[model samples]
Every structure is written in structure tokens, then in C-alpha cells.
Target: MPDEPAPITEHLGELRKRIFWILATLLVFSAIAFSFAEQIFLFLLEPVIAVMEDRGSKLQAISPTETFFTYLKAALLAGFMASLPVTFWHLWAFVSPGLYSQERRAVIPFVFASSLLFAGGAVFGYTQVFPLVFEFLSGFDTSGLIEQSWTMSLAFSTTARLFLAFGVAFELPVLIFFLAATGIVSARKLWSGTPYAVLGIFVTAAILTPPDFVSQVLLAIPMLVLYLLGVGVAWIFDPERRRERIQARDEESPGEPGSDSEDHSE
Candidate 1:
């Protein structure tokens, strides 16, 4: 027999517990990141620094608290990055009770893949996307008539947004895997909806990326690739679809007695 559904109060309590643990994890990691805030800040600033060096530009602090706040934001970003694995684990734990035994067995792989993909996305944004964006932005000073000093706050916010956008975007495959595994969507349906998915992806890219064609295209390309990859993942792991295919094949072949009854029982 299946387990009973959890009571509403129990569900709420579980949610609260998950939230508390996630918050605690965030705080602890944030504290650790704060200790290395300067290094994190510098690491994130590399692309900007490269562009600025080429153009002899410098970053400035417009307000007295700007530098402090920028460092604080950087620490928060770093903390979140460091705590991502724990966060994902908590998320999986929270939802695992609704999954089958076989599905629950996927927790470790899910957490590991989610973390790896997010970090890979962030690194790609920093190393490949940011440099191109910064280089493009630097070109606006071709006339050299205007001063090209960017404030620390602006730089931090811009880089942080892109880092976050890429990280979240990279989770597409994992999200699709879950949806497929849960029977919310199927690989065949996703494949048939390719055009619509491409459209949605471009729209999402436009929303997430900076307001420039180059940035939009760069983000969209990866997102499109990830979507296709997600469809492949869904095809491979979707149990419902696999069962349907098996049923269809069985119906087409000459079957032993009681096969239909066995299928109905299943």
C-alpha cells in the first residue's frame, strides 16, 4: 500500500524546517565568504579590470558607503554560490517524499549535477560572456571626449546579475529531468514543441541578459542548446513515456495469455 498523504500542518512544518536550514546554511557560508570578500570581489572584477586596463579606465566610488556595500554584495553572492549544493539538497529532501523509491534514489546525482552545472554556467559567464560584454561596453568611448569611470556599485550589480542569470539558466536540463520523471511532461511533447521553446528561450534571454543584441544572442544560444539537451535527457529518463512505449509494443506483438490483465494490474 502507498503511504498516506501528509497533513497540511505537517507540510507547513516541513517547509518551515527546510527554510530554516537553508537560511542557516546561507548565513554560515556568507560569514565565511565575508572573511574572503576582498578576494571574491577581485575575482569577479577580473573581466572589468581587463577591459579597464586596455582603455586606461578606473572604477570609482561615488558615495562613501558604495565600496562597503559593493563588498557586502560580493560576499552575499559568494556565500550563495558556496551554499548552492546544500540548498539544492534541502530542496530535494523537501520534495523527495512525493517521489517513488527509484526516483528518491536520484537525490545524490541531482544535487551534484545541479551544483556542477550552476558553477560551470557562472564560470562561463565570467570568463567568456563578461569579457565580451566589457569589451563591447568599452568601445563606447571611441571619441575619448567623456570620462569612462564606472562606479563600484554599478560594476558589482551588473556582474552579479549576469552571474546569477547564467547559473540559473544552466539548470534547464535538471529541471526538465524532474518534470519528465514526475510525468508532468514528456520527451515527445517537448520535441514537438521545439519552435515554441525556441521562442520562449529568446524571450527569456532578452529578459535575463543586458539590453544588447550581442548579450541576448550569447545567452540565447546556450539556452537553446541546453533546451535540446534537456529534451534528450527527458527522452532517456522519462519512465512514464518508456512505459507507454512498452505498452504500445506489447499491444502490437503476439502476447502470452493474461498479458493484458497483468498490464492493467500494473
Candidate 2:
């Protein structure tokens, strides 16, 4: 017999525990990040520094508190990135009770894939997208009348937002995999909705990226690619489709010669 369902109070208690674990993980990573906050802050400024170097410009801390706050913001961002694996694990653990035994075995793969994809997206933003954006903004200095000094707070905020946006966006394939695995959507259905997906991707890109056509296009292109990749992953791993294929194969095979006699005896 199957096990009884958990009580509502028990479920709530489990949820609270999972939430605490996630929070504790975040806090621990945040503390570690705070220790290296200056290094992380400088690393994040690489792209901006590259552009500014060419123009003989430098970033400034306009207020006395600006540098301190920038360091704190950078530490927070670093902590979140560092704690992603723990976060994903807690999330999966929270929902694993509802999954099949086979599905529960996917916990490690899911966590690893999520972390890798998020990191890839963040790196892509830092190396490819951020440079273009900075370069485009620098183009506005053609008149040579306005100075090009950036405040520490402004630089940190802008870079952190782009980093986070790209990282979240790149989890498209994982989201698709979960939706397909859970039977909430099919690969064919996702592919058929390409037009609408493209529209949504562009809109999301516009909202997440800086208000510039170049930045929007750059972000949208990768997102569109990732969406298509998601479609392929869903197609390859869809459990329903696999079951259908197996059933079709069984139906096509010849039955045993004495199958009728066996059925009659039974």
C-alpha cells in the first residue's frame, strides 16, 4: 500500500525548515563574500575599467558612503551566486516528495545544470553584453563636451543588474525540462508557440537590459537561442513521448502463438 499523505502542518514545518536552510546558506556565503568584497567589487568593474581606460576616464565615489555601499552590494551579489547550489538543492528537496523515485535521482544533475547555466549566462553578460553596452554609451561622447565620470554606486548597480538578469534568463532549458518532465507542457507545444515566445523574449530583454537597442538585441539573441535549445531538450527528454514510443513498438510486435490459449486459461 502507498504511504499516507503528509499533514498540512507537517508540510508547513518542512517548508519552514527548507526556508531556514536556504537562508542560512545565503548568510554563510554572504559572510564569506564580505571578506573578499573589495576583490569582487574590483573584478566586477573590469569591463567598465576597460572602456574608461581608453577614454582616460575613471570611476568616482561621489559620496563618502558610496564606496562602502558598493562593496556591500557586490558582496550580496557574490553571496547569492555562491549559494545557488544550496538554494537549488533545498528547492528540489522541498518538492522531491511529490516526485517519482526515478525523478528524485535527478537532484544532482538538476543542481549542477542550473548552477552551470547561470554561471555561463553571467560570464556571457560580463564579457560580451556589458562591453557592447559600455561602448555604445561611450559613443555619446562624440561631442567631447560632457565629462565621462561614473559614480561607484551607479557602476555597481548597473553591472549587478545585468549579471543577475542574464543568469536568471539562461535557466530557460532547466525550466523547460521541468515543465516537460512534469507533463505540464510538451515539446511540440513549445515549438508551436515560437512566435509568441519570441515576442515575450524581446519584451523581457527590453525590461531587463538597459534602455538601448543594442543591449536589448544582444540579450534577446542569447535568450532566443536558449529557448530553442530548451525546445530540443524537452523533445529529447519528454517522458510521455518516450512512453508513447515504447507502447507503439509493443503494439507493432507479433504476439506469441499461444497467447490466446494463455488468456483463456487465465
Candidate 3:
């Protein structure tokens, strides 16, 4: 009798199950977030409130529904952020079996690093960058001028954009590490582009930030630091060099594919 078909079919079944599980988890978290949406909004607005308080200014909502929508938006963001680990793990599990042992070893570290870096970026934007930016921008109000009233929707949108941008920027090292691991970039090449890269970081900062030097510098400096750190990470994961080292070691002793031989001598 022909043996049962290989486990390839089982992989598809497993993938579908994992996908369902991930969706269910996200839905559950999203509901929780939606229920406490107001608290989430308040937490999100803390930096804005702190900055305004420091400047002796106030933020206002123009529309009756503005605060509610802002809370809803914050809930969605919170849901996605909180569920990221579950999403990543599902994806990792789906692709894991197809990978060699070494590839499998790399997956967890990559996921953890990406999540941590993103969190670091969000914290930096909230705790440091936002305050400086608001302080600089508040100066534009001028004395005896019409009092500025900040709309809730506008405030939420701006803060969300900043949070997302910084979080994405923090993934630079993961991007570089993957590219280097795939042999698409080399440590030497990345090192050589340092000057241009630094210029590009600042230029990007200028484009994305509000029209003020303080915000621009705050974004650019951290971006440059992240890029430099990415280069170091890419160097460590440089696949071409890693392959060469492995090959040289292999040539030193004949061995079966993917297996090492035990040195035997009397």
C-alpha cells in the first residue's frame, strides 16, 4: 500500500488553523481596546497635554463627535500595536517548517528585535521629540494674537502620524539585517554610504517634521543613530561573508552535506 501522503498537506491545514487563531486573538484584543477606548485616548493625549500645560496653553475640540472619534481611533491603534506579537508569531510559525535549523534560529531573534526597536522609537517620540516640537511650535502663537484652539481630530492625526513614523524608522536595523543576510548589501557598502545616508536621514526628517528646526533635528538625530546601528547589525549578519567563512571551514575537511565528521585517530 502506498504510504499516506507526505506531511506537505498537513502544513496547509496547520497554516489555516494558525491564521484563524491569529484573527480570533486580534478580534478579542480589538474588542477590549474598543471598550476602554476613552482611556486609550487619554493615554495617547498625555504627551500633548503635558506639552500644552508646560506652555500654559489649552487644546480644544471643535466638533461634538471629535473626542469620540479620537478615542475610537486610539483604540484601533492600540489594538494593532498590542496584537503585533500574536500576528508575528503566527506568521513565524507558518513559515518555520520550510526553514533550515539555522534559519529557524534567526526568526525569533528577528521578531523580538523588531518589536523592541519599534517600542523604543515610540517612546522616544512621545517622551522626548514631542515635547521639544510642541515647545518650538507654541512659540509661533505670539503675544496678544488670536488664541489658537487645537482641534481634537487634528491633534489625534498628528500624534498618530508621528508615532507611526518613528516606530517604522526604528525598524531600520531589521531591514538592513535582512538585506545583508540575503546578500543584497554588504557591510563595506553600507559603511561607504555613511555620509550620503546621514544627509538623507536629515532630509527625510525635514520633509516629515513640522516646519521647525527643533522637530527636524529631533527626528534626524535619532534616525542617524538608528542607521548607524543598522550598519553594525548588518555587518554581524553579512551572509556573503558568513557563507565564505563556512565554505572555507568546509574545505578544511571533507564532510557529508549539512553534516560534520568526527575526527577519528588512534
Question: Cα deviation of 51 in candidate 2 (Å)?
Answer: 1.3
Q: Deviation in angstroms for 219 in model 2?
A: 1.1
In candidate 3, which residue ranges exceed 4 Å CA deviation? Answer: 1-27, 54-57, 90-100, 206-208, 246-266
Q: Per-residue CA lDDT of candidate 3, range 102-167, in tens? A: 767777787788788888888889887886766666668677566656676787787887787788
Q: Could you give candidate 1's per-residue lDDT for residues 1-266 as a string of tens digits?
A: 22479999998999999999999998889888998888999899999988888778788899999888899899899989999999999999999888888888889999999999999999988888999988887787677698888888898888898899899889999999899889899999999999999999989988888788877888888989999999999999888768988999999988788999999999
Better of 1 and 2 by lDDT: 2
Q: List the residue pairs that clash in candidate 2.
A: none
lDDT of 1 at 243: 93
Each prediction's total of clashing residue pairs, residues at least 3 apart in sequence or on different chains, is 0, 0, 0
Highest lDDT: give the candidate number.
2
Which one wins on TM-score?
Answer: 2
Ranked candidates (lDDT, high to low): 2, 1, 3
Sort by TM-score, best first. Answer: 2, 1, 3
Any runs in candidate 2 off by more than 4 Å, and if so which? 1-5, 256-266
- The 0-to-1 C-alpha lDDT of every candidate, in the order given, reads 0.89, 0.91, 0.78
Clashing pairs in 1: none
**What TM-score do all the candidates reach, one by one?**
0.92, 0.92, 0.78
